[model samples]
Structure formats: structure tokens, C-alpha cells
Target: MADLSIDFCGIKSPNPFWLASAPPTDKAYNVVRAFEAGWGGVVWKTLGEDPPAVNVSSRYSAHYGKNREVIGFNNIELITDRSLEINLREITQVKKDWPDRAMIVSLMLPCEEAPWAAILPLVEATGADGIELNFGCPHGMPERGMGAAVGQVPEYVQMVTAWCKKHTRLPVIVKLTPNITDVRHPARAALAGGADAVSLINTVNSITHLDLDRMVAYPIVGEASTHGGYCGSAVKPIALNMVAEIARDPMTASLPISGIGGIGNWRDAAEFIALGAGCVQVCTAAMLHGFRIVEEMKDGLSRWMDTQGYADIAAFSRKAVRNTTDWKYLDMNYQVIAHIDQDKCIKCGKCYVACEDTSHQAIARAVDEAGTRRFEVIREECVGCNLCEITCPVDSCITMVPQESGKPYMNWTQDPRNPRAEPAPAAAVVEQAGA
Candidate 1:
């Protein structure tokens, strides 16, 4: 088996799967169970000054699929409601018991150096491995100017990261907010502040539901609810793009990335690694399933790496990053035309309706001599836009065939009789004279 261990910014773990700062890691008992269940680590919830956080009942709502299985989740839950002293004690105990398992406590407080300076030592005294600045909680804490608000501004991100670096001996991992215009701005700022690593993405704005009978938005109740941060498979693409952008940026390229957002299976983990994430963090999926899910993640990834002939985790990580590029470099002259296999057609009419209403009216409906409605492609009229090919529900019923230049494929663009762009060739005049 390939070795899955990693030393991310001096915090060593058996594997790269760490629970995010959410309900799964809220207490010591939960974390100990997670470690035993094969999770490499847990960010021991979000901690603050001792008054503790107040949470509401029904603090969450879930979106499910056809079988009512959870596909995505939403939360109005706040930070830890336990006393800071209790949290510190739990962190101390958990670290002492499982020294091999990484224990990084996530911290969020007021945006000043004095408050940060005061808290770093207290957290470090627990003998924890590292500290992660919680700059990405989008809903509850943003209104107080600490979560997404702080993350939205690159200056504030720098200021807080610098303060953490100055105050704590532990390596600092800046958790980023996805609510910004560009994720790279704050990521670069974190590196400028001397942060050792960065983790993302905290969640996207979302509306889970609307109450029709009560006429109210969900969770917040009485008053309308604004969008809470969205997490799950749906947000994976967004997170992957942002992670790639940060990883490829010249200013931030060398900085370590802890990829989060929509990571459920080993494939998701592999994608994060390919995009330059050193380790991957998951919350919603792990919580949706159990922590034992990591067992599958570990086994699947190891098997895949072995088959690919990679020696270890680092061998495959960021392998795909080298291939990612911009669109302008793509070959512009390559072209394809759509083809439909009549034998494979189910006559669902999905492609015809989609093409007619939403895209170009390239596909035409006609009555065959047998008095049945039939769909046919007018090769002369078809521009090969591929709307029909994509919308076709049947597999292989529609395909796009590459058209060679000067081929006799009769599309609207190549017709000499049609007057759109290119002028009639002088050879055509000779042909007309000869006629």
C-alpha cells in the first residue's frame, strides 16, 4: 500500500483527511472517536473568548434527492457554545491521548492584534499542533465583522494572519472565505503575512427553502432569511477553480493549500491534490455519512495510486496542475458537425424541442410517408452548434463528427451560394463563364 502520511507545515498525520471546524469536531469525545475511526485529524471546532456562543433550535435544514437521501446541507449553527476553558481542556486531553493524530484548533475572534495576541498562547498551552484562523464562516460571524467580512478584504486578511504569525509559535493556516470577488487576492495576502499554509473554501451563499404556509424563509424564522453558506457536491466545481487559481498564481504558487469544499470520495480528494492541495478537508460529507467513510477514501486512493505506479501521496499531488491552461491557446480552426444514428434514436424528441426552442432551429420535425412524426437533420441548414447532440438523452444517439477543411460537408458556413462572410472565389466566375 502507498504511504498516505504527510507533514503539512510540521503537523504530521497518518492521512490527509481532517474534519473541518463544525459539529463533527465540536468536542473531545467526537474527535477521539473520529481518530479511532481512521480520520487522520480534526480541527477542534471554532474557539473564542469564554462567554460561549448561543445557537437556536432546528439550527439546520437538509436538501435530499429522490430517495430523500441527503445531497446537500445548510446550517444556521454558530461557533462552539462551550466555555473556552472547557474547549482548551478538551484540546489538551485529546492531544495527550492521541499525539500521533493531528490536532489543530480553529480560532475566530475580533480582528485586532491585542485580542489575537491574548488568545494564541492560551490555545498553544494545550500542546496542540497548530492554529487555523477561521476567516470563512459566512453567516453568523460575518454580521459581527469577523467571518466573511474580514475575509472579503485582503487587508484585513493580511492584518489578522500577520498577528497570528507574530503571536503563535504554531504554524498558522488561514481558512479562506469563498464570498470574495477573487479568492487569490486574500490567498496572496495570507502568504504576504507569513502564513505557513491556507485552507478553503468556507461555503457559498444559499437558500435551502421557502415556507409557503407560514410564508417565511427557512431556519431564521419570523423574519426572512438571507442566504447561508452552501456546501456539498454542488459547490465542488467552484472550489476546484478557486483552488487552481491560487495554486497557479505566481505570487502564491509555493504556499501550501488545504483543499476543502465538496470533497466526498477519493476521486474528489485526488482532484484536490492534482490542483495542488497538500491535504484535503471535509465536513458535510463526513457528517452526512460517518467518519468511517475515510477508510474507503484511504483504500481507494491508495489502490488508484498503486495502479498508476505512484510511490506515495506527493507523487500524484498536483500532477494535473501542469496541464491546466487558458482558452486563447486552444486551436480555433478545429470544427465538428453533429450526427444522429437513426438506429439508436428512441424518438424522445428531447433534442428536437431543446434545439428548436433554446438553440438554433437546426433540427426539423417532419411527417414521414408512413404518417409518423419523424425528426431529421437538414445537413445544409445545420450549423453544427451541438445543441441537439448534448440535449439528447440517449447515449451515442447523437455524436459530433469533426469536419476537415475543404470537405464537402454542407453546413451554412461552407456554402458558396450563401452570402455571410467570405466572398465568392474568382474561380467561380470562370466556372460561370464556361457554363
Candidate 2:
């Protein structure tokens, strides 16, 4: 089997799958159970100095998909409500008991160097693997000048990261918020301040639902509600893009990334690693399904890596970064036309209806020799948009076939369609003139 272990900025875990800092890691009981269930590590839920933030009733709201599967989850819950000294004691004991598992502590403190400085040494004494700066909580914590408040400000992100680095010898992973305008700025700021690694993305600011009858929002507390941090499958794309941006950025390219947000399965984890994450963290999936989900994730990822002949996580990590590029760098001359397989086609005219009515009139119905009507593509009018393929119910029944255009390489930056493009060669001009 392929090795699943990773050393993320010197915090080595048995595998790359760690429970993100959330309710799942809120206490030693939960952390020990999660470790017993085979998770490689856990980022103990966000801890702070002195009195902990109190959470209210109905702290969570969720969006459901078809068949009532939870697709997205939002929460107004604050950091651990227990006292700081109790949390530290439990963290220290948990580390002692599960000495092999990675135990990184998550922390959110007032945006002062003093509070951060005070907590770092205390957490380091716990024998934990590392600490993650929780600058990404989108709701309650932000209102208190912490969490997203600090994360949204690049200067604060830099300054606080510096304080943590100054106060602790442990690896510092700055958790970034997705609520910001440009996530890269804060990511760059984390690197500028000597952060050992960066993790993202924290939850997105969102309102999951509203109760129309009551004229109030979901997770309605006393008939009132506030926006909460949103996480789960819905946020995966956003997380992937942000991770890729930082991974590809020249300034932060070498900085280790801990990918978080909407990682539900092995494929999701694989995609994150391919995009340049040194490891991946999960919360919602484990929260919904339980800690046992990590077993499937591990088995599936290991089997896949073995099949691909990868020796370890590093062999394929960041493999896809090279293919990610700006729109201007895309090939404009590449062409593909959709082809429909008559044998596999159930004669469902859904594709024809979609193409002819809503999209390009690229398909038409015609009678075959047996007098049975069949839909055929009008190649001349086809734009190769793939709308027909997407609308087809049968999988692989409609496939995009590459067309031999005999055109040389051209991108948006070099295409004649772009007014700023350089003058075309005489041969190209003659060819266009003949057409």
C-alpha cells in the first residue's frame, strides 16, 4: 500500500487526514474517540485566554439537498465554552495518552500581542504538535475584534502571525478566512510574517435559510437570527481556488498548505493534495457521519495511490498546479464537437430539446431508413458548447470528440479576435481572405 503519512511543516501525522478544529475536537472525550476511530490527528477546538465565549441555543442551521441530505451547514457557535485552564489540562492529558497522534491546538485571542504571547507558551507546554491561528471564524468571533476580524485585515494577520512565531517554537499554521475580498493577500501576509504553514479556508459568511411563516431566519433564536459561518460541500470549490492561488503564487508557493473546507471523501482529499495541500482537514463530514468515515477515506486514498504507483503522499502532491492557468493562456484554437451514440441513446429527445430550444440549434430530428425518427447533429451549426452532452441523461452516450481544425497554437492573447494581438502573417491573412 502507498504510504499516507505526511510531515506538514514538521508536524508529522500518521496520515494526511486530520479532524479540523470544530465541535468534533471540542474535548478530550471526543478527541480520544476520534483517535481510536483511526484519524491521524485533531486540531483541538479553538481555545482562548480566560473566560470562554458562551454559545446560545440553536447554534446550528443546515441546508438540505434532494432526499434531505445535509449539503451545507452553518453555525453561530463560538469557541470552547469551557474555562481556558480546564481546556489546557485536557489537551495536555490527551497528548500524554495519545502520544503518537498529531495534536495541534487551535487558538483565537484578542488582536493584541500580549494575549497571543501569553497563550502560545501555555499551549506549547501541552506537548502538542503545533498551533493553528483561528483567524477565520466568520460570525461571532469577528464581532469581538477576533476571528474573521483579524483575518480580513492583512496587516493584522501579518502582525499576529509574527507574535505567534515570536512566542512559540512549535510550527505555526495561520488559518485564513474566505470572507475576505482577496484571500491571497492574507495568505501572502502570513508568509511575510514568518508563518511556518497556512491552512484554509475558514468558513464563509452566510445565512443558510429563513423561516418565511415566522418572518425570521433559520436557527432562529428567540425569533431572531444572525449570519453564521458556512461550511461543507458547498465551500469546496472556493477552498480549492484559494489553496491553488496561494500554491501558485510566487510569494507563498513554498509555504505549506493545510487544505480545509468541504472535504467529504477520498477524491475530495486527493483533489486538495493535487492542488498543493500538504495535508487535509475535515469537520462537517465527520460531524454528520461520525469518526468512522476516516477509514473509508484512508482505504480509498491508499488504494488509489497504489494503483497510480505512488510511493507516498509527496509523490503526487501539487501535481496539478502546473495545469492551472489564467484564461488568457488557454488554447483558443482547440475545437471539439459533440457526438451522440445511437446505440446507447434511449431516443430520449432531451438533448435535442435542450439544444434546439434553449441552446444552439445544433441537432435535428430525421427519419431513418426504417422510418424511425432519430436526432442527428447539425455539425455546421454546432458550437461545441457541451450543453447537449450535459443535458443527456445517459452517461457517455454523448461525448465530445476533438475536431481536426488544422489551426496552429493560439491563445486569447495571440488570437486575431483580440484587437491587441500582433499582426497576422501573410499566409494567415491569405487564408482568412480566401475563407
User: Highest TM-score among the candidates is held by which one?
Assistant: 2
TM-score to true structure, per model:
0.84, 0.94
CA lDDT, every prediction?
Answer: 0.85, 0.91
Per-residue lDDT of model 2, residues 43-117, tens digit only:
999998777888999999999999989999999999999888999999999999988899999999998889888
Per-residue CA lDDT of model 1 for 302-321, tens digit only, reads 99988998888889887776
Task: Give the per-residue Cα lDDT of candidate 2 at 161.
Answer: 92
RMSD of 1: 8.2
Each prediction's RMSD over C-alphas, in Å, is 8.2, 4.5
User: How does candidate 1 score on lDDT?
Assistant: 0.85
